[model samples]
Target: MKMSKVFRLLFIGMVALSVLLAGCSKSNQATSGDKKPNELVVGQDANPTTMDPHDTQDTLAYGIQKTMYEGLLGFDKDMQVIPVLAEAMPELAKDAKSLTFKLKKGIKFQDGTDFNADAVKANIDRLKDPANKLKRASLYAAIDHVEIVDPYTVKIVLNKPFAPIVQAFAHPAGLMISPKAIKEYGKDLNRHPVGTGPFQFVEWKDGQYVVVKKFDGYWDKANAAKVEKITFKPVPETASRIAMLKTGEAQFIYPLPPEQTESVKGDSNVVVDKAQSTIIRYVVFNVNQKPFDDKRVRQALNYAVDKDALNKVVYRGFASAPESAIAPKVWGFQKQQMYAYDVEKAKKLLAEAGLPNGFEITLWTPNDTIRAKIAEFVQQQWQIIGVKATIQQMEFVTLTNQLSLKPEESKLQAAVSGWSPSTGEADWGIRPLLSKNMFPTAGFNSGFYVNDQLDKYVVTGLESGDEKERLNAYAEAQKVIVEDAPWVFLTVPDNLVGKRKNLSGVYVLPDATQDVVHAEFK
Candidate 1:
């Protein structure tokens, strides 16, 4: 009996040992598999002031929002409008007063709410609400009301015939937020974003980084999020960003300084992408203030600056001199050389403007390396015409706030800035910058420059149904704006981008934002 008991105990011990070894083997295999690819890290030069789509006016902020929120429509690589949440391109009524959109079926928001026509209506109502005070309200000023035809169909009625309404829907102004999330978060929705995009907002570490993760339940699984995670690190210093890219810490960086392009290209593990951009850098004269109020003074400044030399020196030959406010790729862009580098003509114009001895002025510029260089170059050139130019640099947000203020309150004489129309339309590019109705804190016309003739042409371009008429109207408006010289047209910069060699599916849109939804590590 004692021998039988001992044998049974031995058998039990062996079985237990076998089970322990099997469990260890399985755990080892799982651990090896869990070592997946690292997340993609993108380095940006600026941090977004807010994440709310309706409140943000900065491009970087919009780029971050694009990862989490999607509009009814979106722009393709060629800048053409394409349907996103919508089933197809919206059908316009014969009278051109309404647009009907068929929403994609079976889509659900990240917050588990059903996405329907009512959600679209709710988004529009929130944006159009005066109590919300959205900066993008002006973009949807033409919307009379939204009608839900069914669970998956909606119609947007316009107060009048507006040409840019369709294009506006593709912009950040048309980004659809989850109504359920909005109701829950309310004023805090900027930080708590919920949408039906391929990625979901994970967390935002203030002044450090904003992180996002792939949404497994994304409707479009074919082009679903490839990367497991993405972290947008705010590295304002160009050198730091370059260092991060080289050390394999960051996979992408924007606005790569022209000087560093060659070095980045020399690296075997990195690549550079250069695309023609719609960004126009210019100096906005405070027409509400002295000397600048005179067209002759503005024209003289435009003539005095050697744009070609500025492009070569500041942009390192990576920029093209703009003929007008609109870029060359934009329709209705004039090929005419509106202003040539003529010191003598500039001097003559200054004398004609009754400032023969030249007047002292302060030129404000954002605290950006490129803009600062441009400002310094302009200051030197203006000195040749006896203009005592003082350069003052401030943060971009602060400068924009000062520019938005009334001339008496802001004391802004002139500021160096740039504008990129995200809509990819000439009407959008010209209207907000030159229209009188857009002045005094209405959609980026901070210079407060007003021209009745230009405004009329812009309005006609926005209201006309015929393409040729709209083209002619915009062309004429450009000519008038060049003559008025509200801004000294400088150069259209090339979007210089840097990325790791292993990073694929990254593209710079015409509007100069990175499309990283399909980005992956090879």
Candidate 2:
């Protein structure tokens, strides 16, 4: 053969190999597609601190744990309390001190133990037990005793009329765990959570991922898990989380930062879901600390920071400044006159509090992108008033633990934080944050604020079953708390979730937790 003919033959052979490889690639693609999983992967802001339903105060943890646990009560999309394990709403006595619930029958825990009146009693007993020292124990303090009327019937006797009891029961703190698991694991139950939710705990790889699988014996088949498995992966970086969603690495990601919403919306493969949130973002002060101990200084900080600017810059106007101690979406929210933005007025208040020169303070925030931005904005705003704010960012878990320290031991001066009244009620909005008894060791009142009048009003709100009376009481409490300025009230942000367009049935609730019970891949 001539040299030209040999060159032509070599070219033909190369082209043939390319065609063969292309066909093999197509075959591999089809084979991989056929084995695609019916699983949901969620990218969240942070790792859950615990799996124990009764022990955690961490919002992220509770949200994930919700998939594996359920309470006798559950909340609808509107945050209204509804019966879940219970057959119907409880029957209240004339005095409102006693209530009875009829449990649903044929429900079994993930551990195969029966879910009955006995399970309810076991949970209540654990929460009320002084030795257990659960983080949410104070929420159930009004419960005097639990009486089993039958296998499926139970009566709760409260020491007094606790108006928010039913609503509180709808909270994750009320989520029931297997009594058998509770007894076996005891202190270590955080590692081995077992419940009767639509999903059962598969495993938790700390700082990595947590997984749950469909519970085959899940009682409510109509609302059963639509996916074989759900994996919660903590991707604290905002950009990384969005990239995961866009690339199909995750089915859902929350909360989609407000600034990034428009960008994510433009992606055809992703959908943004918004829910009006009960989350109240604020900068809480440590009243036990020097300058902050002065209400005028606290008020000055609130006056100094322009809430409208903060919302515009940090939340891109997707958030609104809180008009009450609680978000307006929560039940019994009463609007109040909040501190107006005035740098001069802020300086005046500081001078009146004997700090005319302005003092130096530390503001701690979680190492979150948004929160760090909040701290930075607050720092710049306070600078105009001669206030030198040194911003410190730490891991969320560390920041939370630092704040939980007893007032005398805690070194927290000011911290940027947020709370969602996950219970969707006024008492939860006020009691855990402002009531005197809630200080440090007892509840989330890390500020160590004390006001006898405010305390009385919260108690009144909690003890009264009358709607009018409770409303009036909460109104008064909000007035006192707003005036005292324990916190530089920030914004009530909308819960933003980014999901794959093909996904449905999962959403971020008004309380800002993910409800994944019905999540499915289309």
- Provide the clash count, candidate 2: 0
| C-alpha local distance difference test of each model | 0.85, 0.88
What is the per-residue lDDT of model 1 for residues 161-189, given as tens digits with 9 covering 90 to 100? Answer: 99889999999768889999889999999
Which residue runs of candidate 2 sit more than 4 Å off their true CA positions? 1-36
User: How do all models score by TM-score?
Assistant: 0.90, 0.94
Q: Best by TM-score, which number?
A: 2
> Tens digit of lDDT per residue, candidate 2, span 119-189?
99999999999798777999899999999999999999999888888887888899998999998998999
Steric clashes per prediction:
0, 0
Worst 10 residues of 1 by lDDT: 29-38
Q: Could you tell me the TM-score of candidate 1?
A: 0.90
- Pairs that collide, model 2: none
